[model samples]
Target chain A: MHFNNEELGQLEDRYRAKLINSLSGFKSANLIGTTDGKGNHNLAIVSSVFHIGANPPLVGMIMRPHTVTRDTLENILELGEYTINQVNADIWKQSHQTSARYEQLVSEFTEAGLTPEWLDGVKAPFVAESRLKYSLLLRESQTLEINGTVLVIGEINNVLVEDDVIANDGYIDIEALETVAVSGLDSYHVTNRLGRLSYAKPDKKPDVID
Target chain B: MHFNNEELGQLEDRYRAKLINSLSGFKSANLIGTTDGKGNHNLAIVSSVFHIGANPPLVGMIMRPHTVTRDTLENILELGEYTINQVNADIWKQSHQTSARYEQLVSEFTEAGLTPEWLDGVKAPFVAESRLKYSLLLRESQTLEINGTVLVIGEINNVLVEDDVIANDGYIDIEALETVAVSGLDSYHVTNRLGRLSYAKPDKKPDVID
Candidate 1:
């Protein structure tokens, strides 16, 4: 099938959303955990998280304008802190539940039946069911001019994970943790390893590292 | 195990890169195809692609600062057009090879042994082997102040995909097309879908859609 710009724009609203969302291929399934600073906790499943840099350990995610996600954006800006929890197969249903529009005072942790745990120095709560998670400090927030979506960049303040998941060279074996990937809006998937390739070099084809 | 910011900063650079990159979980594996408008085509495998919005069909990807990706960035800025091809298992090795730093005039398509084909009215070349691909017109480019990385936003000009892969509700069955996902910088993966859940509502638990 071929769809040009005008043809794509003519697609039905929800249909276009699913078609365009899946065009990015597989996405990271994470739950952004934040609080209003007065005990009201918020958790929303987001597939937009992407790695920004390694030296400063930055992470970036997109927040859609005029949605339930506004709570998450506001909390991060107000408190300068948030937690990103990887949604595994075990807790994906609960994580998806967090997307429902709940009142500002209602905590998604309770509504979704997930426990909120606190780290030693982090202000935001972490999903106890999430085996791989981290705390982030808000670094920057910018609204794209073409669209109202907000780009939220954060610095990784700390990482929490199991020791067994880390390989010798610091590659986290996410498949071992069963970290899921999201496609479209609601589909969840678990990945199988296809072997790691060596660093690309101009003179040779990449070799399987293992 | 937990690593605070200070400890994370002190780790070896390459090790930190692997760790930090993997923290974002599974990412979309895409081959960004661009040209200098003088027939010098460039192809680079990127895992940073993420969906920005649906109304305008916007897609965003990050370009690392001072890297081989400079070729891809320069080409997009000059021509205002590029193609995003979903990397599948059959051509993943070839796609990874595009990361190698080649001379300004060297075409990665020739080096990696993949064929580039162009569609009507789109200047950017598309991977002939890519079952699901799309052409994008550059809409915005912003250099992130926190990091020197550039965020490239583009509007979807056209999409080319197999008809069978699209479902009734407009969800593209990428698993059927065998589009792969990336972990860390080198590992590739194929996914097994768990299930698609229904949209969340405050009154009830989400149901399995299929």
Candidate 2:
């Protein structure tokens, strides 16, 4: 559509789109489980998870502004421990619903009808339904300037994956998890595999992808 | 599923995807169109496009570590101009096919069976089919350590869009464009409007979304 620069900016206000996706597409985790030092467990859906570094196996997520009221942010800051649970289509509705403004003490797990299973030593609980869950420890936290969001970097201290879902190599068969991507908001999408582009190996022919 | 450190690291090779998505998922762009420096155009897809800053609107793209050889890379470096095309489900197949390594200098438009239109002053062409296209000028190139790929950031000097798409606020209604998003590799996705999040306006409920 033809729009002058001025016209487009107005849409930002009329539309109320958060532009939270400024990061990248394909959000990995629907729920981030965190806790406070007092052991209060809080759950929230985090769609901004991104890989930061591989050497240390670091992953990061952009926690929306003022999520400080939640426990996940508290746990990471106070206990430096948390877990990421991949959300699949089966529970995406409940997962997205967790975003509703609930009291700080309200347990989203109970609110969403999800089972929170605690790992042996980990403080936070894992989404029992999640095929893949990572028990991570806080690595670093940075506040981004453009927006008032905290970039939580975590070290993969321990990982829990359903057998047969993970290929021997790191390639995860997300298809097995049936995890979907988050669109603007309140929308969930089931992702189907379209075939992978061959790794740009030194001598391989570049294949046409579907 | 329960796995220890040794086992998880073992599967890292395949299961651990790389962090090529520098797209904070926030202020990123979908490649909206592509054209030859001389004016012929081709429509392709990209989600890794990001902005370095606004003073000049510097944008960059992280070519996948798979398929798609250095042609587009060379083309941009040589001609110094290329249009980034956005993909909607309407042409998701054609846009998805551009990931292929076609004959060198073969117009992806012809291969994908799409058309390209030229801009008046720029060397590269824009995808005439795109709801939005930004004509960018090369700015700076930086090589990322992990992937060995150089991220080319450009300044958006001009843009092309169908007349009706723009609003008065200077923000483009991308949802109106029905843009498609890329997941790990081959998946083409249609996004549904959720609610938009905000940076400064944390108090207001996210009632409006694209």
Span of 10 residues, lowest total lDDT, candidate 2 chain A = A16-25
Candidate 1 per-residue lDDT, tens place, B93-115, comes to 99999999888799999999999
Q: What tens-digit string does per-residue lDDT give for candidate 2 at B1-210?
A: 565555646644434443222112221225434444554443445655643333334444555333363656656766676666566556666665665656556667777756767656767766666666666666655454543545566656665655464444334445566655555444444444433333212233333333
Q: State in Å the error of residue B114, model 2.
A: 6.6
Tell me the TM-score that candidate 1 gets on chain A alone. Answer: 0.98
DockQ (C-alpha based) per candidate is: 0.90, 0.19
| Best by the lDDT measure | 1
Model 2 gets an lDDT of 0.56
lDDT (0 to 1) per candidate: 0.94, 0.56
After superposition, candidate 1 runs with Cα above 4 Å error: none
Local lDDT at A180 for model 2: 60
Alpha carbon deviation, residue A32, candidate 1 (Å)? 0.8
lDDT of 1 by residue, A1-210 (tens): 999999999999999999999999999999999999898889999999999999899999999868988898999999999999999989989999999999988889999999999999899999999989999999999889898899999999899999998999999999999999999998999998888999999999999995
